[model samples]
Target: MSNNVLKNLKPYEVFKYFEEITQIPRGSGNEKGISDYLVAFAKEHNLEVIQDEALNVIIKKPGTAGYEGAPTIVLQGHMDMVNEKNQGTEHDFDKDPLKLRVEGDMLYATGTTLGADNGIAMAYAMALLASKDIAHPPVEALMTTDEEAGMSGAMALNPEHINGRILINIDSEEEGKLLVSCAGGVRVSVTLPIKWEDIKEDKTPIVIRLRGLKGGHSGMEIHKGRGNSNKIMGRILYDLQDRVSYNLCSLNGGAKNNAIPREADAVLLVNKEDVEGLKAVASSWNEVLKNELKASDPDVNVQVEVLPDRYNKMFSKETTKKAVQLLYLIPSGIQTMSMEIAGLVQSSTNLGVVTTSKDMITYDSATRSSVKTLKEDLVNQFKLLAEVVGVECETRADYPDWQYDADSKIRRVFERVYKEMTGNDPEIVAIHAGVECGLFKEKFGEMDMISFGPNLYDVHTPDEHISISSTERMWNYLIAVLKEIK
Candidate 1:
């Protein structure tokens, strides 16, 4: 705390805790360091805390004065962040603390993702628990883990551990907007078998790369019209089926199953006589992609690079056809829009990751839909594709969507108090992205929850940043809401 980047910022305790925790790496599936740090912080403050097997931390504080009898208000947020960085970023999510930079009104991490999506929730909960003057009810801080990758932490939380009926999730992006409902989601992966054979004719190995697209959170930015590298690569190869003689050796791209893939590459063994023809297609395809994505992703690039080393094995013709067919046939991007809520995406899928192995190639996708039937329909579509293409498809982390509650007490309290404080009504809406709230709802059936936070932009991307002024505003609003609850 001696030379903290955000030590002097307003709401000193919140920023102070935020900086301290940022010093600990808390990427998805690697949460022990930060989880232990949280337990230590709770002990330092003398709060009752519980650390579960999944590294989910729950710290309990008794209500202040007359509010001791008030129902427990759960302050919930995940502990892990999506570990995403720029291609040339010189930072490690495993050990390095985020390099903080404050610009005008926004706070960003240089070349890496700032963990403010849910880290701010921890900071706010810490401030609430540590405050001596602020009034509040019995507070339970439910800090789970691995939310960006999946809802495993939240799913593993024991229901008997919580006595809170009112849950205020501080994981939303916009400050003044209250998220009442969110789309449910599941992670689906398709593994296709590939047959390898020795190349008979001498062929030139060339790598076709697609990059520079503005990739983002699949659910949040799916309607943005950004290019999906995996899908685009499939289209390229499919197009070349007639013009060139080639066999795919390997194709891979993307890191996370929930983030839109920004870059992808495919290695092809082309006949020596057809090398120029493949390069010609690559050049023409590059222009086509640029023109199509000019408004949404102007920097989109597609290039072919000649490999110096030679590849001995190439995918069999039958295997290659199945692979390209599976990639091109899979459904992606916006599928449906809400009729009740204008401009809201109701159903969508993201082709997030592509990888090749010794005998199989896998494609991972995240499917989100607010409607249960629609979500099921989307998964069935993939299953049908797998049946036709002769591949294996599996789904996991299936969570339901949170439905709207008309008599939400916590929401009313927030709306009324926020209006009184800012002289304007906060925007009330539902998001297409998945949050832990849905899983919590499944765990506690009677849970009444609302999700909101400060202004965060470009989540799950290296350009992610949070608004400074919005944080201060949110802090004040949360404090007021806690006091008013009783």
Candidate 2:
């Protein structure tokens, strides 16, 4: 229970469990280790536990003596964390544990994500399930998988597995806000055919590297005007087509579909005479990008890497043109703002990834919208663009938006408890990002749901961290809410 990184932290039990879970790598599409660990913890406490085929773990505990007949309460959160780090940081998310560090009131991972998004949820659930003094109704801890890239884990849930009508989802980022509605999203990918050609004797290869932009959660921070390196790479190529003759080898950027692209690298083969000119152009463009992003992404830059030896391969001129065209023509960033709510974004898209393979190039985008028709419209818009450029488009891991519930009993309990404890009313909010509450509503219409969490900043990015004092307040609030539910 005592660790140097978070030693003697308030709310000892929650931090203890959080530190333990951080030692195990739980990145998206890789939840077996964390899931099994949850099962072990449940068994150690002599509690009933079930793990589904998709690696979603559910642990059940009976109610206290006084609340044996109270309706069951379901606590849920995702198991996966967005795996991101500083470009040069040496850490493998699949195997290495997050290196925890404390800075004042914040908890951080050295040069990487801290996984506080939902890891704190698991920590809180573990603390509650193992405690002998807390008063509450029967508890069902639902830990799902792959909520970072997609909501596949939540979508794969079986109705029979969840018996609780009142659900508390501990996945919100803000401490005092209760989320009532959320935007639905889909992952759309476009694949284009490529033709590789041998390096020509007269060509010179130089890599254009884009870096230093502050990429963030596409849903949470899309309105901040942060640069998308994939889009910038496309813009550079499209603009330089008239000044220099070149063929592209590859255009790759981004690590996750739900995060804005922070850096991109593109290789180009140009006429030997145009190499110097290209470098000059890159320098000017770098300055331009910095100036434009002074407020949003001040460190934005572009570097030209000239190798001592000639490159071995390059894409054919036809394939190069098609690839550049796709990058240039496709749209990204916030698409539309909500007219109903002030300062709310209605629809947006993040062109998060671009990768080159042996025979094809793929562009992955995460599109979100609170309105079903608008979500369909944006996905269809991407497909139309793909059709024009002779590329294939496909959608996967789609999830429904959670609508606001005005008559939610769980929400009323939260609102009352939070006010009684804080002497102020908690803010009722509708988020643009997706949450599992929407999927649960689809599966169980009568279920009452609400989401709240500690203060987490810069999620889905390397700068992610959680507040220490906020965690204590959240823990106290959760216990108070649970006791009131009975």
Candidate 3:
């Protein structure tokens, strides 16, 4: 089954490059293949290109005709995509190409992310660079790596390598909305050691699983009030501690540090007689959870299954108590709402992933805020929570926020062109999620920047998709903006 549905799409060159990109695996931290491919494309087109040590690619194209004297414009987007899939998708993002499909006006992949968040930016840049008729200024197309995991490529870039003073970032998700600023973020990891013990006499093994929740991008969808599976499991375990005697064997959930967890599972050893009681408790909690999240997650499921084989080892009673307490106490979801912006989320955290190993259990979270002091405060909060439980916590991949520029020349050009084309003004606003524009601004203080993209839904999740008609419209709008540049 070839995922070549874009062959007959309109705006042939844009979709053509997108189709080619989808055939390559370019997940974060594994972008060498795609970076090399971009270099090869530039070479084939007889253009100047650079592939940095961090695998970031920059392709330079001369301006066309009368536009040769115009100022150079930088077209920026990341080459990496978040690799997320359903529980049993059987697809390997590190090796297999995405399985693309078209339904109505949208394009999506089977049981996985479509990567359109930034991939379409690369496609648009490539198409424009390869064109001979489109009027534009000198172009520098910058494709970065490891952006989903962190802004490592952007962080590694030297300011001297880029000469463009006007930058247009192609990483936003909504159409007709120009992003002027964005929040900063960091990844936090906490580890707690536990002691293991032999299971007591006549104890049975059982598994509790939560699934079917509508997980989404942690930063963008945090305010949606959807249920977090890890949090749900914590409540269940806390309730079971008083009703039934059990020993925890293993606990795990979630994949990315930037996505809300949709599924979580736990294994436990309980006395044979307590199995039925645990099931009843799980059922009761399921009903309660459904009622609590009915408006957001209508399809949430909670299941319990008993195993024939018994587990030989389990966490000590003290360890079990501390683990449950940690999950219950740690902060997750929206922490604050913007008082200035009408409906924007100000500060937030996602308790993204949890895992257990032989010596320790680890919790990974992503926190974001536009205020530098508030972002640091959230990290301190996480550290304090871990300290109380005698665990260790650390932060990584800290990126700065992009502040809005009220006097940006490039933004004015974009707004003027959008209104002339659509007969309506585009909404200009700031986003809560992290974008690479912040790193660019830090490196080049005088550069003017703005971010925009086509309409996309459920980004960073399995249900991610891009609208075909909106993509064509965005392509036209980008071309119009380029023509207006001076």
Candidate 4:
């Protein structure tokens, strides 16, 4: 099944390895199977290997004949991929392999994410390791797990296990750009206790839904000014407060802290007499939002539907007010841009997930900044907001930023190789998105690193895909760089 799709692809060895990888279920936090596969590959090739408790794999290969005395080079990429699928996709990420297909110059999965972000890097590394002809220094292929959820695998890796002074990170998304630096970040989770009472006899139950937003990676597309469904839903509820009396029953939306919320829905009990008024308010906002977000979210939708039976219970008036206020006030997009690097986002927060249960309503937010102080300040802001709303707040998955190195030799080598291969100099820039390189820098201060990869679009979402021709070019560029390394 995989052969027919990849038969015409160049760098045949790399694509073969990639197809094999796609068959294994390697979603973040579920990487034991892929980790074992790497171990087996290393053994099959008679290479030295280490499998850590965190499931990070390190495979070592001696240098080629003439380059035996050269410095060891580390090729790094994460083993796990973000698990995302379309609304009605039936494939299970835990056991089913990605359904692969080719479209023009790009490769994608049917109704799901393609996982080419870092999987291609793993394929490149494996192909290089299995080669007997490509010239290179001592190679260390480091594969870490759970990079999408957090940098857990990289955080747990011991610096002593690696001796390489030069590292090439293959986890970037662009085709002709080199990622020199990235933001540090942390996840903040807030829980607010809800006080619920039986629904009043004179009230009616209705559901308000905000959908059709074109959501993307929070850090990558936050500056695009797309509508956040959770935030929009909050605005509708807050605005309706003055015209209609409603008690919150349930509010839920979004799935991950890294992806923007594409849809959100809320259930409420409203005075029977004000049902039509609430629907009118929702319709009015729908038009306003469509106009406001037409450029970035042309398909923005706001819908209100009445329920046949009333909800058994709803939040008390005070709790409802607090919930609405918190949603309205929490920061949801780019907060500031970089002063040092023009057009770069310096600090931001994403209101990623919102959910409500009988006992509590919880919000999950992700905050990021290239500056440590600014990152802390953004986190503090969330903490203060949660405190004001009388909710419990905690932060987790804190990772450091990968600072730019002006004197990096590896960056220069990659730039030179890229120019020679494509007749154009690669753009060197920092990204707002978080990468495992940050954690690697924190662990190994002496390591000089740069990140580059083939073109991948819409990562962390169902529209994800990789450019086939770009992958071939990147493969040749990497081989050239390896041969030039001293």
All models: lDDT?
0.90, 0.89, 0.89, 0.89
Which candidate comes out best when scored by TM-score?
A: 4
Write model 4 residue lDDT over 269-388, tens digit each, in one string: 888788898889988987899899989999998888998974678899999999999889888788888876678988899999999986999999989888888898988888898888
Which candidate has the highest lDDT of all?
1
lDDT by residue (1-486, candidate 1, tens digit) is 324888768889998888887778899999999899889989999999999999999999999999989889999998999889999889878988888888988889899899997899999999898899999999999999988877789988999999999999999888789999889988899999889999888889999999899899898788899999999999999999889978899989888978999999999998888888899998688789989999999999898988998888999988888888988988989999988667889999999999999999999999999887899999999998998887899998788888677789999999999899999999889889877888888789999999989999998899999888899999999989998877
lDDT of 3 at 304: 95
Clashing pairs in 3: none
lDDT of 3: 0.89
Evaluated at residue 343, the lDDT of candidate 3 is 79
TM-score of 2: 0.75
Off by over 4 Å in 1: 1-48, 62-69, 79-119, 130-133, 146-152, 201-208, 243-246, 267-283, 301-312, 397-400, 403-407, 455-472
lDDT of 3 by residue, 1-486 (tens): 235589888688998999889889999989999999999999999999999999999999988888889999999999999999999998999889898899999999899999997899999999998998999999999999988876889999978888999999999889999998788898999887989997657788899999989999898788899999898899999999899998898889998879999999989888889999998998787789889999999889899999877677899998888888888777898888777656788789998999999998888999998777788899999999888888899898788877667799999999999999999999988888988998888788888999999999999899999999999999999999999886
lDDT of 2 by residue, 404-429 (tens): 66678888999999999999999988
Kindly indicate the candidate among 1 and 2 with the higher lDDT. Answer: 1
